[model samples]
Structures are given as structure tokens and as C-alpha cells.
Target: MSLLFENAIGDFELSTATLYSPTNGDLEATRDEPVPIDGIVEYASYHDRLDHPEKDDWIAVPLHESDSAALTGEYIAFTDHALHGEIFVYDDGDDYESIDRDAFVESTLAERVRFWHSDYAPDDPPSYFDSPIAEREPPRRPLSGDDAASFFDELESFVRAEMDAQRDANGEKAAGSTPEALREQGFGAIPSLSSLGQPEDGTYRFRIDDDGDDRAQDRHRYVQREFGIFEGNEVQLFPPNAERAPDAFPIAATVGSIEGRTVRLAVDWHAIEDRSTVGGYLRQKRRGYAVTLLLNSVPYDRELEAIARVRERDDHRALLTGETAVTFGDTAGVKSSQQDVELNQEQELAVSCALLADHLFCIHGPPGTGKTRTLVEVVRRSVQAGDDVLVCADSNQAVDNLVAGSSTAATADERSLHAYAQHGADEFVLRRVNAGNSSNDVVGERYATCDGRADVVAATNSSAATLDREFDVLVLDEATQATCTASCIPLARANKVVLAGDHKQLPPFSATEDPPESAAGMSLFEHLYADGGVYEGVGVQLRTQYRMHRDIAWFSNRRFYDRALRQGRDVASLADRPALVGYDVGGSEETIDHSKRNDAEARLVAHVVDELRTEAGLEAAEIGVITPYTAQVDAVRTKLTAQLERGREVTVDTIDSFQGSEKVAIVISLVRSNADGEVGFLDRPLDGPRRLNVAMTRAERFCALIGDWYTLRDSRGGAGDGTDLYDDLHSFLESTGRLRRVEPEFIPIPE
Candidate 1:
């Protein structure tokens, strides 16, 4: 039996131990054959029945101080425990496994409770185990003088080797490494640069870029390339303007592809390109942590204590909430006398919560409850108080929406009032910052760049965190869709944090089965909102919805929001029209296509949309199509685009994509048409209602639902049916004389 490459540190400790025929991974839980040890004895299993003091099945592997020959690492430990019983391993101590913080947090109480005896070979059985860790600080490897030099050296080597490998593969490098490639001989008046073009599968051609010959590129000359990746585009080339490039200058690329000159990236391109770039930041975050304990750079000492205060104990929740005295416009020493910026009760309360909040505040905003409008108040108030503000969201559109609302240029003569009237309301400052990975092209030229000294900076949360600047307030919009760990990036940069989002909207979709943890898949808004009311209340529930008709909104209001949703005057005017209408599309026994595409239902939705636009005298922009799947969204968009008039544009998107957005009328296509009554996650017990809630409320005037009534409404088929939302809404639709039936005109499924 041998132990090799052991790392004994705080939370992580790895070792390759062998109990059976030299296994490559973790130590065996049990052995086929036992070997004699010097003085090792197995204690009775901890769960062992008979009154054994140490009842666990774990056997402690002794620390052999006398025989240092067995271990090679400074942080290696010999006393390991093992036993492969239920959840935690417990037989032999011979395994190397990576710990998943998310998994640890999500694990059953029994799973976690059983974890201790296996990891910690305690001399005596302890009365209790500490709480599972949800977050940690970024790891710190304090650099020595040698370490700093080594970092540069390694960086240089990595850059050179990586570039060479690409150049060699692309047949671009000269016979001997150019002096320019190895080390530029001297500084050129201008740095020479080129651009990259994909000539072939494995070839990239470099062409000189004349930056009108920007003379600023003249200093250090070498061949260089900087690359950026945003939405839809895989790579963007910013060729150096210099006639020559530095032998080694920073390139804004995850994997350098030099077609340009020197590039001092705005943010760490590596972090954007590959989240797992050198540091364990991403990994720690995935495991449910801010990594606040790892490095102090990101977290202030007070922040560190605050983290512990919230996470280490529940007592702080009560204390923090009890002491919080929130009042709107009270955060800043100066209160705005501008009556033009008056807020509604919920909006004012949300701003007050943010103002009075010492650490955190949550705003529970259902769709169309004016989350963005409330956010505008917070930003203007912050700016009026002379505080730097960073507003962030999960999506680029969400951030842009916030930016448009706060910036004087976008909302100039509109409803929103600017804070700094000194520059006039039409010219108050704002910056629309985006992650380098953002596809700003779709957002128009204004998104490409903005003035740096704007009163408010709106950015994708991750990009906002790398800004190399600080802010007094951090407001995360659409916060429910971001992981708590990722949310910490922006949160750490500000003293106070405010969150706005509806938990019932889309939960974050993760590729990996193991999700990040905090309060268990509940977003930051959800976590704070859950405990806030118990004390003095750290959040204001946005209850006035202006997007959906009173009757159309009734289902979600009664079910999701406890019937507190009030329709604004605009929505109330829609009462004369039918709020909800249903169309049955499975007239022919045709099932949904293999890709979950309901062509028949999709066509009916488009047909209904055209009818609404022409007969109701509504513009195409007034209509929205909501579906459960992406395939259906595309299908509907294609169909609707073909049917609508040349200048008329309609909004078509998946249910999740339509959240935080609204249109006057909504056309929903329920794609699932199965004989077996498969509902396709729409009736997924818990998620079904939430998804349906968002789908139902995006309309202001009329809502037309098209689908298989048998699949949704009558699947269980009884008066007291144990059916779903569709069944309940189906009866309601009947009472309102809004139900219609349509036959399917089947289309071939795409390959």
C-alpha cells in the first residue's frame, strides 16, 4: 500500500492511496486481502450496534512520522479514514477525490452528516459537525519576488509556445523564429500590425491594418494579435496599429492568435475566454462560493466578516433585519426635492429598502410590475447623492434596458427624470458597459462605447465586476437568473447591494448536473426575501402589474401572487376585450414532431396573430408569442414573420426569454400533443406553474392559447380533476366565451 501526491490543505486534501492491486484513483473502501500494519487497529464502526465507543466503520490511517519515506508532499497526511457504507465512503483510506461544494451543499443532511467521520480522522467523536460551506473567498497564493518573476517568465513561455504552435500549424512562422518573434531588436517608431482572416481550415492569413496609421502604435514593435468574442461572432480581431509588435505584449485573447500588435485589454480576456483560466475562481464559484476566504483582494476585511456573519450563523439574519431602518431617498446625505421623480408605493418601498439597507435588499418584482422603473429611482437617487452606481443584470438587454431608463439621452423627454440637472435632463451622464463577450452589434453603435465618467454604468454583471473601479451601490437586475457565486463579483465591489427579480421566472439553466449552492438554487433575491419579512422587512413586493388584462391576469394573480396583483388603468381599459382565448389544434390525431415542434399549433398561433392585428386594429408590435421550447419559438417566429405585413413586427420568444418584457397581446402555442398525455415540463409539478405564470402574464390586452386540450385540460378528466393550470384556465376560458377549435394542417418534421 502506498500514498502518493498528497495535498493536505484547508478544504481540499488529495492523496492517491492503494489498498488493492495499486488502484489509480481513491483508496479502496474494502480490501480483498488484509496486510499487517505496525501498530494499526481498526475501531468498531460508528454505526456499529454493540456499545463500541467508536462505532463508525472508518479505520484511521495513522500518521507515520517515524517513516517519512512514505509521503512526498509537505501537506500530505497519513491518517486518512474510509468506509464505503451509505453515502460517505468508509472502508479503506485509499482514494483521491475532488470535493464539489455544490454537491456537498445539496447533499442530504444524512449525506453531509456522514461525510465528517470519513474526512476528519478525529481522535475523539465530536458532539456536532459544523454547517456545510456555501461560499469561500478566492484562493490566495501570495507572490514572492521570485514568484512574480516566475509568473512573467511562465507567461512569456506560454505565449511564445502557444503562438509558435499555432503559427507552425498554420504555416505562418519563418524557418528560424523571427527576432521579432523571439525578442524585438529595438522599439519601432510605430508598432507594425496585421489582421487575421481564416483562409482555410487550419490556415490564418495576416494582413496589415492601417489604423489611418495611428502613430500611437509606434512604441514597442513586434507581431501581435488581440482577439475578442461576443455574441454570434466567435472571434473579433483588433490588429495593432503599430507597424511592428512587441516580442511579448499582452493580447486580449484566451488563446493568443497574433494577427495584430500590442493590446492592453480592458478586462482579463482570459477570464472571459476560459472561465477556468489559471485560478480556481470559477471552480470555487461553481461549488457555491464567492471564494472570499481564498484571497482578500476581492473582499474587504469588513466584507469577509460580513460574509461570515451571514453564512456562519443564522443569528445575524435576525440582528441585521431587526436593526435595518429603511426609508426612501434616505441613503444619501442629500435628498432630492424633485417631485417629478415621485414613486409609487412599491417602487418607493423598494428604493427605501435599498437606501436603508446596510448590506443587502431584495425587490420581489413579478413581470410588468415596473422592476426597471423601480431600478431607475434607485440609480437616480444614488447619483443625486453623489454615489457611484453600478447596475448589472444577467443579460445584455436587461442591462441596456436599465441604462436606457437611467441615462438622460435615452429617457430625455420621457417619464424618467435625470439626477444631475446641472448638465440638463437631456444630457445627464450614463455608460453602457458590456462584457467583451457581448454581441453589442445587435444593440446598435451606442453599445460599442460610452463616456467613462457617467453617473451610472450599466453592464452585464460579470463585466461590471472586472471594471477596475469601485461603486457605492450595486444593483443586480434580473438577479434570479444568475448564480449566487457569480452575483458576488459585483456585490463585492460595492458596500451596499440591491436585488430585483421574480423567482418564479426562469431558474438558471446549468449544463452540469451539480449546481452552485447558496440558499439551494434560490437566487440572492429569493434568499433575502425569504427571511426579510420576519424581521423588519428587507424587500418590497411589487404588486401592481400593468401588462396584463385583469381577467387574463387573474390566474397567476390568484395562484402565484396571492391575488394581490392590481391592474393599472391601462390594463383595466382592456377589460372590455376577451382576456384569454383557447384553440384546440389536435383535431387530426397528429402528434408533435420528434423535435417537439407543433407545426399545426404554431400555424394557428400565427393565424390568430394576423386576425388580431387586422380585426382589432392592433399593430404587430402589440402581439407576442410565448412557447415552452426554443424549437417552437423559432417555428412561431418563422410563421409569424411570413404572415405579418411588411412593416409590422411581432415579438416571438420562449417563455423564459419573454420574462421582464411585455407586449399588448400574447399568443401562446402549447407544443406538446401526445396521445399518452405527456406535458413536456409544462406540468412538471412545481416548475410547470411557475413557467405557466410567466407565460400567462406577458400580455396587456388579449391572450390566445393554442394547444391540445386533452393533453393539458382534460388529461385526468374529472370535475374535481387533479389536472394542471391549463384545465383550470380552460374552464375559465369557456365561461368567458373565448374557447375556439382548429384542425391541424401537418407539416414535415425537420431533420
Candidate 2:
């Protein structure tokens, strides 16, 4: 006699058997005949791990849960011959067929009752199961051929536009036009170079010389700063007199070392062998020969290569389509915890969904939500399961946050991410791969330089592409701020991808206007959840926030999140603290030189900072002053520094620089209070006003907004001018008694 069990989920095959016994964890099964009625089934001794068994002819059996539970111990006693019939089993609101009762009774009487399970969970049963695989929507189509080319072209064009904008902002142009054009101008036209030292091995050395031109010096500094050539970056080297021949064009070389004004270039042997290339440039002209460094083309070429080869790779296809060969169920034992405090329900669900994802998963994290905490838990569990994981983000600061954990710990005794990571560091290797000089004392002191094999590696998205090995999973934090093509370089190296970001906060930015017909200008994180995208209605959203007070969170919660955001357990409300305080400075906005600044607003902010310091006893380090423009940042920082007591340092920066940061008390300076009601980039169309959302969510206890109410509310910046957001804030603050006009000396919280 043989028993046959049918699975409710159709996609996966029965790979392992599980039996719950009080003494031993493994299942003990002895079968005379194998069955393959519907799905692949296997039965073997608990001690002997067996592969799929051969198909056999077996009669169906019916069994009840109560009857199965009653029979305990090693085996159950049953009659050899009984009535044959199928059992209709309802498992968690789903219906499926079970083995014949007579076959099961005889089989169980001879052998123990067998339970199907996954190989990943041999000790524990699955705590939760996702929706049936058959019910899920088909994976989205992957971009290929002409569509792929067009998408990459638009993405590259957007990058170029941003580069050009930066150059224009700094009042500097590119080095030269093209190879042919540079050759037309004499080799002397290029920047002069001198030999650094004697050649060693395959490395060619040169020193960048000051040609007595200020513009040339500025351009060199720009290249070094923008391209990060001193931080071991690679750039294309074009000798001034390099032959115009096809093979003698610019050659790729690594920035081996940079000291003072000298640089060492590690050129390939092939390029060094050719007399017309780098070797000849270094050997023939030891001094006075000009060389041009092509800094812009490196990223463009790398992105194009990733796009060109993505479709040919299976993992890349999976990343694009959200389909994978393997699937997972939530591990029941994995609990979400930050040291001692357990995670909220929404955060726990996000952790489960991230693990259960087959190919791609998107975690929609609103501001102040415990998305990072949730993601770190997922990383710990993934490493425990012996999967090599890669964590990446658009910025080095975001990556450092993931590695070192939160600086603003919610609880006083809460342990940091480094502590959590160090707990399991002995079990597996953890490495921090940074491309920039960003380092906090927390992460920098401990993991400043970790080499060799690593079970988990944290890096920026740009640096992840340079890794030699692939990862089992890639966790991309702050994914919404990176372009699709920028994400593809790391996306190509992993089989599964998890994206965690807030789409409502900010999308990928382009200095130039987006192409009229290209969706590639948007971030992949937003694209996946938009309208008919693959993970559309399927991604998990963390609804609870632990950082902001309820009053401070109310505007963004209602405006952007549709009131889905709520305060955590101990979060303060209006009754507990002055959460949302507004000061209508009615300041006159003016553009000094070329940058925008408001003198009245700056003075008002300085007064507020002074009051907070004298009355509330809040130090400058505890408070943050944020603005929208660089000139305004300088203005606020200057005024606050001069007005405040000596040795008081207040953190002041633009909105973009403070994306992944928070503070105890925060103030914002809206510098566009002009008569024309021109808000500049504050109210851009299509992209929405995400900068305001980011700015408002940074405060934990108290938040203050100082702006010209008339200019903001009566903006004439066409459709979607974002005036409605300011209107909403005004109404909310007025109704809640949080709005106040700026006085000579004002207090954040009225006594």
C-alpha cells in the first residue's frame, strides 16, 4: 500500500520530507513503493537523504487531521485492507486532494506518516506561505534588441546632461572635443606632463604639470575631484601625439597611485607593447608631452557594456522579468529584532517578503520607517542560511549607514548594526568595500580595512560592479535615487535583487529635461511599482515610523502616504511635544550675485537657534538647519555660527546632502520669497515636490518651517507648482494651533 499527497502550490516540486517527533528532528520513513500521482514525491529513511524516487502505481487514500494527529510514536496500527477513496483536505483556506485512506492506513501501518517539506527547512516547518504561484501575475517582459538599445541610449543621455550641468555650474568646459579634433590642434595644445619616476613593471608614470593657465589648473582639479582619480579610479589616457590610427586611440588604464602632482598609470601589456600607445608616449617624450584624461567617458562606456550584455545573462533576465528558477517560503524561526526591541508587524512582513521573493522584491519604505532595520535583519538571516549577500546603495553615506547601523538609536540601550554584525562575524566574513573617503568613527575604526573572502559585502552601486565574484542576493538601499542604468551594473551580478526605498520621497534626477517618450529616465524602484509594472500591487509597504513625532509626520503622511504612516509605540504627539511649529517670516527673497538667499529668513533662523539654545538648552549639535539652495545654506550656517556662542557647531546643509540623516530638532529655510512667486526647482512638474517631503521628515521631536507664506501659497509656476502642499500644511498647522508668525525672539515650544 502507498499514500499519495498533492500539493496546493503547483510551481514547486516536493524535494524533502519532514516529520515532527518529540525526540528526533528528522523524519523516519520506509516505503516499499514510490508514487508520482500528480507532483514529484519522494520517501526515504530520515537518516538517508534520497533524491526523487521512481514513479510507481499506487491507490489514492483519505486521511483526516484528527486521525493523523491521534496516531503517535514510531508508527500507527491500521488494517491492511480498507475502503479506497480520496480525501478532500482544506489547508489554510485552500483545497487540495490527499492520499487514499486505505492506502495511507496500510502504508502508515507499515511505514510512518510522511510529511513533505523543503530542504532549506529540515528542522522547522514553514511558518507562512505566500500566495499560490499559479495565482500570481506573469512576469513582466524584459527589454531586448531595439527596445533595450533605446532605453540605454536615453539613460546615457541623461547622465551626459547631468555631467554637462555640473561643468556649466562650475564655469568649466570639457578637456577636448574628440581624438580627431585634438590631433588637428598641435600636441602642444594639450596639458603638459612630466615623468614622475623610473618605470616599474608594466606601470607607466607621469606627473600633471601646471601650464601657467588658471583655467587649465581648475580643469585638472575638477577632473581629480569629480572622477576620484586619486581614489584608485580608472580613466582613459590619450597621448597628445598618439597616431590618428584606429588602434592608437585612447587606452584604458588604472590610476595606480597619486602623490602630490604625480600619478602612476597601470597600463595593460598589450597597450604597453604597441609603440603608438602609452609605452611610446612615456618612452619617447619623457617631459613636455601633453596628455588628456577622458573622465566622462568611463562611466558611459561601463553602463553601455552592462546594458549590452544584460540580456545574454540568465540572472540579468531574472532581474528584469522578476522570475527565478528557485522560490522560498518564510522561515518561521526568523524574528525581526533590533537588539532587544521587536520589529512592528509591517516591518516584519517586509522581512518575510524580502526573503520569500524569487527573483525581485521591492520594499516601499516611507520616511522614518524602520526599513533599514528590517533590511539588516534580512541580511543577518540570509547570512545565517549561508547565502553570500551584497548590500549596495547610491551614496557612500547610505552604504555606511547599512554597515555601521543607525547613529540616532531609538532606544538608549539599543545596539548598533556593527555590534549586530560583529556578533555573527565569526560565523561568516563581513567586508566593507568603500569607493570614497566617507568614514564614521563607528564603522571606520572597526571595519576600516577588511580583506579576503566575505559572506556579506557592503558597497556603493558603482563599486559593486568592480567586485570579481557574484552574490546570491543583492540588497539595494536608497534605490529610488539611482537611475535604472546605474543600477544595472550591480543588478547583473546577482540572481535575486531586493530594492528598499521610498518612491514618494525622490526619484532619479536628471539635470536636463527627460526625453519625452522614454521611461528609462525614472528609477527602476519606481518603475516596478508604477501602474502595470511587474511588482505593482505586490511589494510590501512599511507603514509604521519610529523617528518622527505624530504632529511632525502628519503633513507628509496625509499628503504623500495617504495617511498610511503612523507613530510607533513611544512616539510623541502634539500633546507630548511641540511637533509641528511654523514661522511665517514674511522675509524678502533676493538673489545675491548668482545664488539665491533671504537675509530676513537667515536672521529669523539665527534667532530661533539662539532661543532653542538658551531656553531649551539644546546644543547646536543636536539641532540641524536645512535649506533648499547652496547660497541659503551658506547664509544660514554663517549667521547661526556668528550669532551662537563659541564652540557651538550646528549642522547645516542642502536637502540633497541630508537625505539619509535625521536630527532632534530641525529648521528649514525656504529662500524663494520673491514678489514674482518663483519657487525655482521647489515645484517641478511630473516629479512632484519630493524635496519638501524629505525636508519635513528629518525632525524627530520638533520641526520648524520658515518661509514666505504669500510667495509659497501664491506661486505662478504653471501646473503642478506644488503650492497645494504648502496650502495643506497651512491648514493643518492652523487647525492644530501650530502656526505662528516669526517674532523678534521666538520659542519653538510655547510655555
Candidate 3:
């Protein structure tokens, strides 16, 4: 016997068969069948099994809880007839509880029971059943163009109506007032006049009375009359005073009858505070003594239009340069005393400025070579030439320095670099000049109305690239750090481009990589070499370390330069430089051991803090801790603050946050490799070359690195291994004279 089942949700059907064994109980199984069901009417036959051996067996049928309840007390019984099959029906038994009526009706069997039986007639034809559900379509969105246009049009109409109503309410009839009538009423110039008509030479005459009649008439009246030129028509006299009239006073005057043959007329004029004026008037008609009212109006629309155009152009230029236009007075309050220290690259700065003045040049200097100071001098010279200068740097600190210095040197009204480079500043047109904000064709139009037309524009390299017009001089700080792609735009836009940064520090992150042929490989100059070509361009090498002590500088230079010379690199030789000195650390490698206690890291941090606080007399804000790993940062932070009293404020930032930042003193904690030989630096992967490079370079004025110098030496295999990480760092120190081990100045903490 076969059975049918259906899934209500997806509406799929399953057919099954029952098998009987004389020894075992009845077994239920699935069968592939062409069965005639009640819901699906057709004459069909059932197959006992499929051809596959696995499918030829009967399996037990499992039912859900609700379906099992519906099957209680049901029995399968075979009929005597061949065409008829066994049937099962729900029945209450003594041992079995009655199948739950509610549960059975809500079960899947209750829905399947309706399809169990069908009238099996030989002439029956097949019929189909269709689902009641229907498909749906997605909703539509409204059009933006129509809505936007409608909004703006409505706004314009509303503004125009409001302005017209305001004018009318103020008694300003622009097109229909007379100047002669206004003056005849003894007013100097009617405050509501639109326009004043020129009066005829002798058509009107008047006599002024300083003391006519304060009570009966009014103060300062005028007497009107008709003269020989009167071709009489209706005339209206103002002030309406018959007592003030003279004998034989007529309605009009002739051309020669008036003194100097001139008549003064007044009209309705409106004076808007700090904005504009409007008025109306009355004048004599060409043919008669009678005067006709004439009106003249002055609207501020033209002036407002000019102002808007100027503002738009200024905004466009500001966006293009990443520099906002500002007025000099806005930054006058900033003090110059804040920047009192002289830069170490003073001579190099002068040379750079001279080069920028002479030609399009690049001032390639490494970190601490004072590129920022050099660019400032370049800006100063450009300002001296009466050229508008644009100064751009990669960070806000760089911009601040440029603005602070330039504003201090410039006059109150002179256009400073800040005014042209800061956002929202008055002259920030270059900052606004972007393709999205303005049309490319009209990009430079704003510069036409600049009060100091030859102003300087300063911004970062990214900002400079967006400018459409060429500047008098384009100075790029940290030029070596910029990729070739970033450099191309500014180089193309400037009349003179100055690339300032050191290639030795770090090349652009995006430059293509191809190993140089050899140490003696052809340089950029040699590759492009030709007879009488520009191959001998001068390169300036700065050989000074003003920030470090002479001994520290000497040790660092010895280690860094010797390796470069050994590698056959074109590094500068500083062996004979007298300013260099050697640091004697008592030859003790024992003090370099990793701290044992959790408090050891804290003590080390506290030591550095105490040194900065006592010896350098630095403020907390001027000090920063830069570590190679986040764990080490956490360790050092905990240690530094553990011993401090409550309510003390100190901040610790990661190397990522410290980038493009400067501090008076920086303490570097080099997190040691863990037991598994893992170390991280600057959030970069714990690789050899990168770790060594990053761990050595994050200092502005002072650095105190806490790491195992012994591990560094052991890793290098006696300092001669060419591939060793420490060897690389040692070589850099010798060449640059910027890093060296020394007896750090220690300050004891209070007990």
C-alpha cells in the first residue's frame, strides 16, 4: 500500500509504501510511484522499487510529533478485492489515549489525509491543481531632476516677491515719483526716491525763508512763483503755504528769471544701512510750467551680483590649492616668540632658497636637515619679489610653521601664506578650485580680482596637483616621500618647482622596484647622459648634527658611514669632521639586559620621564613615548603611571599616531622578541629589515631606546655580517651621526 505526504510551506509532495513481514511488524518505506491521489486525480500504478539495489528495500517512516499523534490508533488492513488496497483510520483504544483532536488537526497528517482517497473509475481523466499565490513587482522611485528644479524655481519666486513687498512697505515707489515736487516741499532729498530727473534751467523759481512760521506753517519754507517763461498749465506747489507766498508770485518761472538759471530737485530716496540707496522724483514737462512726476530707482542687485561672483571665484581657488584664503589681521594675535630656536640647516636653507629663486630645483635633505625652515626662507624671498607665494606641506604642523613665520614677517595687510592656504580664510580661492566644485575652463578666473594679486599659495603636494594655473614658485616639502605620481601634477603646474626632502631617509612608498645593476650602477644622471647634457647638477650635502651632543654624533657617524664606504655607496665621508666626538659608555653591556619585573618596564619608563621632566625641564605635552609594539606600549604605560600619584595626566600614543608629529623629547621602547621569537614594530609585520629600520628612526630632539643591545650584536654575528639587521642600523648610525649609545642623564624619583 502507498501513502502520500506534502509540505505546506514549499508545497512539495512525497510518496511512500508499506511492507509487511510475517515475523517482524509492518514496515513503512518510500516508493517511487505514479499514484492516483484525491487532490491529483488520475488513473496510475505504483512501483514496488527502483532498479538500484539500495532503493529496492523498505525503510521505516518517521513522523513529526503532531503527525505521530494523528497516526495513533490507526491500523492498515488489506481488502479482499484485488483492485482495492488496505486502509488505516483513527480509532480510540483502551491502552492508547485518544489522538489529540486539536493537535491532529493542526498536524501535517491532517493536511495529507485529504489526499489519501480517490474514486478509482476506469474512465477517469487527469486534472491539474494550481497554487493561489501571485508574483509581485518592485516599487518605483521618484525623479530628482524635476523635484530639484521645482524647488529652486519656487525659492526664487518667493525671494523676489518678499523683496518687492519690503520695498513697497518702505514707501519707496521707484518708477512714479517727482523730484521737483519733493524739493518744493522743502526736503533736501526724499529718502524714497528711485531716480532724480534733471530740472529745466529757468522753468521754476523759489525763495528760501529761514524763519517762515514755526507754528502756522513750518520751519524753513520756500516761496514759489510763475515767471516770463510760463506757458501755463496746472501746477502744484509743495508745503501748501499761502502765507509764505510773495507778491505777484506765479505758478512758474522763465529760463532767464531764475538765479544762475538752475533749479534744484529732490526725489524719494531710501537709505539702507551699510548697503545701498533708492529713490524717486518729479520734474518740469518739456512744454509747460506744470511739472510731471518722474521716478528713478537704484537696486542693489548689480552690486550683490558682483560680490557673489567674487566669493565664488575665491572659493574655487581655495579648494584647488588645499589652502584657504585668509586676511592678515586674523592671525595677528599669534606670537612669534614661540619659535625662537634657529634651525640646524641654516646654510643649507639659504642655498635652497637661492636655488629655488634661480631655477626649478629640488632640495633633497634627510629628516632633521631643516627642510621646513628652508621652505620658509624660500617663501620669504618670493614675497620679497612681489610674487604671490603658495607654501604647502604634508601636515598641519608644517602649515602652522609656514603661516606663523610668514605672518610675523609680513605687514598687517600683506597677503600671507596662511591667508591663501587655510580653509575658510578670506583669500582661499586655490583651496576651492576643484573639478567637482568648478568648471576647469574658469579655474583661474578668481585670481583676477585678488587685492594682492601677486599672493602666495601654499598647500600640500596633493593640494597643489588640483590647481589649474601655474604659481610663481611651488615648493614641496618632504618631496622624496611623495611618489612619482604625486610629484608629476605639481611639477607640471608650477612655473618653478622646488622638491625638498632627503632620499636617504625613505623613497616614495609607491615607486617601482628594480634592483640597481650594481653599487657602481649608473645613476639617474648617468642613465640620461649625453654630450654637453645637464649631467653635472650640484647636490648639497649637509654635514652637521646640531641636535645631538658631539660625542653621540661622532659615534653614530662612525658606525653609519664606515658601512656605506665598505658597500661602495656614494655616501659622504665625515671621518675628519672636528665637530664629532666619541661617547664612552664604560663598555658595560650588562645594563642592557631586559627588565625582569613587570615594574622593570615601568621603572625604565619612569626613568625616561624623570629625565625629561628634570633635566630637560620639558612639559608633559612636549614628551611622547614611541615603542615598536603595542604590548610594549601597554607595558611601558602601566609602569610609567603605576608609581605616579592620582589625578596626574599623561598620554601615550602609538607610532602610527606619532607620524607627521614632533615633540621636544621622545622615548622609544623597543619591545624584545618573545619566547617564540616574535617582535613587532610600528604595527608592521615582525620582519628583520623593517623592524631594525623602524626601531631606529622615531626621534625629533632626543631618543632613549630600551632594548637588548647584546641581542642586537649577537644577531649580527660580530657586526661584520652584511645581511644582519643590527649591522644595517650600525651602518646608518655611523653614516648619519644621529644615533649612538650614551650614558643617559638619569634623574632619581622622590622616595
Q: What are the TM-scores, per candidate, against the unseen true structure?
A: 0.55, 0.68, 0.37
Model 2, global lDDT: 0.60
Give Cα distance to truth, residue 653, candidate 2, Å. 0.8
Tens digit of per-residue lDDT, candidate 2, span 1-751: 0111112222122343222222231112334553222221222211111222331222112221322312221221111233533321212223322334334323432232333222111132222223322113344544555654465466666666655664343222224354234434431123455665457766777766665555654554443652234434444566545554336445556667665456677764564446554455455545654433434345555665666566668656554555532233323112222222487877766666676554667888998888888887777777775578898888888888887655432221122346455433354567777534566655555554555677788877777767889888889999888777778777877777889898777676655544212455567786665544545534778888889877788788988898988777566532334877887777677676467898778888877777667777777788888888888888877777666784148888888787888988888988877667777777664443788899999988778898877677664554333477787777777788877877533533221
Give the per-residue lDDT digits (tens) of candidate 1, residues 1-751: 1001011111221233321122233232332322222111221121122122243333323222222222211121122234422222222345533222222223221121221212213232222322111011111222345543343233233323333344333222222233234224231111232323222333233333345455543323323212121111112222232123222222222212332342221223342444333222211211111000011122122323333334333333322223323222222422332232546776765665565444556788887788777877777777776778888887776776565443433434233322333233533466666433444332343444545566666777556654777778888988888744445456656767788888776665432212323232335565445432222245668888776777788878887788888876555423345777788778322333334677787778777777776678777777788888877777777776666674237888888788767778888887877666667567665457777888888877788888788877756554322356788788877777878776565432121
Worst 10 residues of 3 by lDDT: 326-335
List where candidate 1 sits over 4 angstroms from the true fold: 1-254, 260-342, 405-428, 435-452, 513-520, 531-536, 570-577, 587-594, 642-644, 717-723, 745-751
Candidate 2 weakest lDDT stretch, 10 residues: 1-10
The residue pairs in collision within model 2 are 60-100, 61-99, 61-100, 61-101, 62-100, 62-101
Output the TM-score of candidate 2.
0.68
**Candidate 2 RMSD to the correct structure:** 11.1
Each prediction's total of clashing residue pairs, residues at least 3 apart in sequence or on different chains, is 43, 6, 80
> What is the lDDT ranking, best to worst?
2, 1, 3
RMSD of candidates 1 onward, in order:
23.4, 11.1, 34.4
Better of 1 and 3 by lDDT: 1
The top-ranked prediction according to TM-score is: 2
Error of 1 at 587 (Å): 5.5
Runs of candidate 2 with Cα error greater than 4 angstroms are 1-135, 139-260, 263-297, 318-341, 406-416, 423-427, 513-518, 530-532, 573-577, 592-594, 646-648, 715-722, 743-751
